[model samples]
Target chain A: GAGVSQSPSNKVTEKGKDVELRCDPISGHTALYWYRQSLGQGLEFLIYFQGNSAPDKSGLPSDRFSAERTGGSVSTLTIQRTQQEDSAVYLCASSPGLGPITQYFGPGTRLTVL
Target chain B: GESVGLHLPTLSVQEGDNSIINCAYSNSASDYFIWYKQESGKGPQFIIDIRSNMDKRQGQRVTVLLNKTVKHLSLQIAATQPGDSAVYFCAENLHSGGGADGLTFGKGTHLIIQP
Candidate 1:
């Protein structure tokens, strides 16, 4: 079975620029999540989407971070006016449903703020 | 804020030995926990999981032990191999969450295998 996939494995952008990262979840998976991993640190939860309900943005860190899942299959994480601190690896994961289920993660998109 | 944390930043184990990684979580309300392994330049891979109802669970060569009373968790790997060299993370479902209450992950322990 095909695993979750993300686009633009590497992205280098200047400060103040906006970058959008994309994620494609596995077929029929109803739960999707996004996390950020900084250098030498654990992954930080960013957002979560389940079915057609509202998305969870509790860990967005700032208003500059936002995400949207279209048709409950593909998701896009957009960061507005990027900052140096925004440089990290953005990973996407999807699961069969929720609650204790395993989340299969994508390769991740490394965002470098230059 | 309640969070999950690891006891060590790194651990070195010889081949064919058992490796144990420890974690402490502050959120006693958390009911589920998971262990994930991440190699260089890749996303985390789910290793195993355990629920609050059960104190222990085993998967293949990995075992997850959870002590809710003390708010601790541990991952034990038997017969460590070179392929086992990676960063191991412990994650918990905050507020029994999966829908919106995202998970909390520990800093991770980088396991170094010695031959």
Candidate 2:
């Protein structure tokens, strides 16, 4: 079985630039989630998408963070005007459906804002 | 705000010994709990999960215990191996009326297995 996948395993960008991270969830998975992990820190919830329902953006730290899942399969997390504080690993996960299901994670994309 | 927290930042155990990690959550509304293992340079991998109804659940060589009264959760690994060394996280899920919310993760405990 194929697991969740992410692109650009490592990305180094200049401050104020925008970066988009992509996630491809497992086939047939209806629930997707995004999280951020800073160096030596715990994971922070970012956004969530389930099927066609309204996405949960409550965890997005600021207006600069946004995400969208097209056709209920793939998701893209975009960070506008990236800052040094945005340097961290962006992780994506997906589950079979929703409640109490296990989320399979992708190898995160490490963004380094220089 | 409600949160989940780990009792220890790191635990060192010898190979073949048992290891236990503890977590305390403040949100009683959280009905589901899970444990994840993250190795360096990789994303978190689901280890096991336990629901609010049951007090304990067992998986291959692993057991998850939940205490709703004390809002406590513990993960026990039998005969811990060197390959088990990683940062372990405890996450809680709050099922909002509308839909499921993102999990609230606790600061992980680094498990160090000494051979």
In terms of TM-score, the best-performing candidate is: 2
Query: Which of the numbered candidates is closest to the native, going by highest DockQ?
Result: 2
Candidate 2 C-alpha lDDT tens digits along B4-90: 999999999999999999999999989899999999999999999998999999999999999999999999999999999999999
User: Model 1 over residues A34-103: C-alpha lDDT tens digits?
Assistant: 9999999998988888874544677798999989988989999999999999999999999988777778
Model 2, range A10-62, lDDT digits (tens) per residue?
99999999999999999999999999999887889888888755456778999
DockQ of each: 0.64, 0.69
Name the runs in model 2 displaced over 4 angstroms.
none
List the candidate 1 regions with Cα displacement exceeding 4 Å: B95-99
Model 2 compared with the native: what TM-score? Answer: 0.97
Candidate 1's interface RMSD, please?
2.3
What TM-score should be assigned to candidate 1? 0.96
Error of 2 at B83 (Å): 0.3
